[model samples]
Target: MYEAVFHVRGEGPYERATAESTTRIDLWCNDHCDLLSIVGDGEELVLDRIREAVGVSQRLGDGDDRLIVTSACLKQHAEGYVEQYLAAHDCLTLPPLRYENGAKVVRVLALDAANLTAFYRDVASDYAVTVESKRELPTPSVDAPLLSPDALLPALSPRQREVYRTAHEQGYFELPRETTTAEIAATVGIERRTAEHHLRRAEKKLADALVDAL
Candidate 1:
């Protein structure tokens, strides 16, 4: 099996808004409507925009972070939606679909590289798409349990974990990285040198732990 991570832009309203703001949105979709959890500033404005765009059936949580249920199916509303295309090409989208900085960061799984490539090409025909990472995964046995971060990673210092995770989630480790160390530092409110130091230490610790286990 193959796993491909794509950074897609110019596809949906959430993507467009997120690109222009610091807000982050994680979405779960169905044929009916989308369930979205939003984090960061401008929650009220974002919510209002969403309500105007598609209507909101319910809202939960408080402050700038909330969980919302949309009245309309976002996939059906967005012209560039490619779920059907993904299904047609035998690609499965792994959720929750992440929207930030005006793009959608999604992971897709396919039986083979050819199907992954075809799916990418088809999606790229309409939207600006960038392949962040792609790799082959060993086929799992029927009895194997799903993998979790706690099972793979050793304990890390809070600061170290924060710095490393910020870098990773923002695509610092991607083939063509989407973010810079300076940007990461700014996001995490640390100096660039300090963030780099923490990240390097975290990486070394993780690598040592993984290698030793192997």
Candidate 2:
């Protein structure tokens, strides 16, 4: 497997809203919805426009900072947009992984270099596209773990991830229990009950995804 990262200055409601609004929007993909989480004081205004985004067919908002956008017919959009171009080429857009001043930063994964080259050629005319990095993904050998950390880690949400990482770092899972749930909570700056709840939920999700996927 091979992967390359690209920064594309796309033209669309989503990109324009991001550029105009003061808030920062980070997006992630899920089974039922594409989640976009906005931060900073201008979140509400930015999200209002996202709800009315051009390609968005249906949307659900958390009323605070997160919006679940559903774009069912992205494949039908004109090829000038980066997301539509990627959809047409059957390429993967892996981001909310990086950020930049005026471009959409995404990592693209392809089975080989030729596919990536074709994707670049097709998309170059539409947007200001630049390749930030390129690298090969190692083929797993017999002794390698069934899943990579990157694949498994997304099972945990951002907040839950902080708790989980703090727990591990403080030896919460050790035989003698070097850290208490309270300490884990303190480390992540959440309430003790909240921390425990998130920790257990995150662990269960990780187990379900990594173990079952294996």
Candidate 3:
């Protein structure tokens, strides 16, 4: 498997605002639409201008100083175009476009070298693309692990896996902790208490699997 990253500061009002403003914006796309998360140095904050700037069509709050925004690119911009291009090439975008000063750094996972090469070639026509990094990842699908993930399939329930993946990917386990259980709850579209309960259950199941392997 190959993981590739690119940094872009293309033309868009929102992209300009993000580059110029103190706030940081990160976005994730679902092939057809997008999910946005924005943060700023705490002060008198306003999102209405951001909404206009980014062309955000819908929003839901995750509380804890976060907003989950949904948009289908009300304006022709880099993000929407990138998502479409990746989807066309059958590539999976690593979630959450990282932003600083209005330019975004996004990661993409390609199943093969052929597709990865195609993606790079196609995107260059539109953006001032630069390969920030590339790495060959060991994978069970392409390569093989001594212990297959299939061995632990029964270790956790579907609900357990769902919550655990969300928690892990959302940086719940990061040092200087970036998110709370309640915030994760909102991100997974579940209740806070339910998220906490499942996270514990998932952890225990994973622990048990590890112990069994040992």
Candidate 2: residue 213 Cα off by (Å): 22
Give per-residue CA lDDT, model 3, range 1-214, as digits (tens). 7778877667665456555554555666565565666544321232554555444566664422255554554334444667777888888775556554556666777878777778888888878777887777777553654232333443343455677888888889899778899999998887999889778867865786688667
| Residue-wise C-alpha lDDT for candidate 1, range 1-214, written one tens digit per residue | 8988888887467876676565777888866988988865557666876886688999998854589999987766677466766887999987778787788878888998999999999888988899988888888787985343433665443466688889999999999999999999999998999888778767887898889767
Worst 10 residues of 3 by lDDT: 146-155
lDDT of 2 at 176: 95
**Model 1 weakest 10-residue run by lDDT:** 146-155
Q: lDDT scores for all predictions?
A: 0.78, 0.63, 0.64
Q: Is candidate 1 or candidate 3 better by TM-score?
A: 1
Across residues 115-201, which tens digit of lDDT does each residue of candidate 2 receive?
Answer: 888888887886688888787888757898434345445434445667888999999889999999998888788799988877877
lDDT of 2 at 103: 61
TM-score of each predicted structure versus truth: 0.67, 0.50, 0.50
Sort all candidates by lDDT, best to worst. Answer: 1, 3, 2
Q: What is the clash count for each candidate, in the order shown?
A: 3, 0, 2
